[model samples]
Target: MPAGEVQTDSIVRDALNCGKQVFIPYIYGASKKGTTNTNIKSMMEMVKLNSLADYESLQRDRWGIPAIDPNTFDQREHVLQTSLEKGEGLDIIFVPGVAFQIDPNSKLVKRLGHGKGYYDSFLHRYQTKFHSTGQQTSQLKVPPLYGLSLKEQYLSTDDEMEVPLETHDYLLQGLAIGDGTFHNSTS
Candidate 1:
């Protein structure tokens, strides 16, 4: 995690304390070579973390962010696995970005990640897998994605800077800044 990125400790704690199911990104197969598709080479899975103790027990990855170790954690439930079994996916996902811009009129949030397309690729995979099962769209739960940003990461509507968006990039439903401010896209 960078210095200006939104911290997840409080959010994780609150979600756990409220008895909400928590899942963290577990990236794998990143080192594979000879794959043209980046998504195929590097895959990410949202694995369930049972309790606050589980959250606390996480080991820090290269970025110093707490992450679940696949080698050690044997009984992991993937988000897709849960969705397939229970017909319910995540309700919300707090995305981290390097920069964010909100449209003044539409209120749509555009995000710029740190140049790694992990989240975008993960989302694309999720949609493809869920729809491929021939399940009803209503039955398949697609969560509203929100961006978590620090004050420095957000660009005001008045600012001239733009967050360049790619075709595969996702628009956030809302944004939560570090100062506890909420910017709802629908509003």
Candidate 2:
């Protein structure tokens, strides 16, 4: 954990100190095949990690996010399968976003991700009622999904601006800003 950042540093530090098992997303370019698919598609995988040494062992990906090196800790298939079948997976997910469009009236928030669609893809399957098909995503029953954003990333809610939505994007249930305030969706 470093100083003068989004304070998730403290969250990690405290979680570790409290003897919590901290797992970071270990992304791999998984090649998928469909019945009539032409291209090999890539997806992200969640990998469970424990211990300080585990954190130190990771290397940054192309996007500069520190991810677990698959050579040391690879638990892709296990994590995904277990998570889909069991509810005892990650207690909370902190997502990073490029911009946020919040509508308190509708109790919804749309996140525009940083292009790779890693979080977007991951959250669609992970979050409780939210799916990739853009159905009912705001029931908030799953482990809390919080979006981490800088204050500048938050768009004005007063204007009712249209945040463009693609079918692959997922909705967030809560938001945590760099300023240290956390906002939960109101139902």
Cα-based TM-score, every candidate:
0.87, 0.73
29-99 per-residue lDDT for model 2 (tens digits): 45431224334256665666676666656676565556766666443334455544553455678876678
For model 1, which pairs clash? none
- Please report how far candidate 2 places residue 1 from its true position, in Å: 16
Q: Could you give me the TM-score of model 1 versus the true structure?
A: 0.87
Backbone clashes in model 2, listed as residue pairs: none
Against the reference, the lDDT scores of all candidates come to: 0.81, 0.63
Best-fitting candidate, measured by TM-score?
1
Residue 155 in model 2: lDDT: 78
Candidate 2, TM-score vs. the true structure?
A: 0.73
Tens-digit lDDT track of model 1 for 58-176: 98877789998777544788876665456666778888999998966677899999776889988987777767766546645677899998888889878888889899999999999
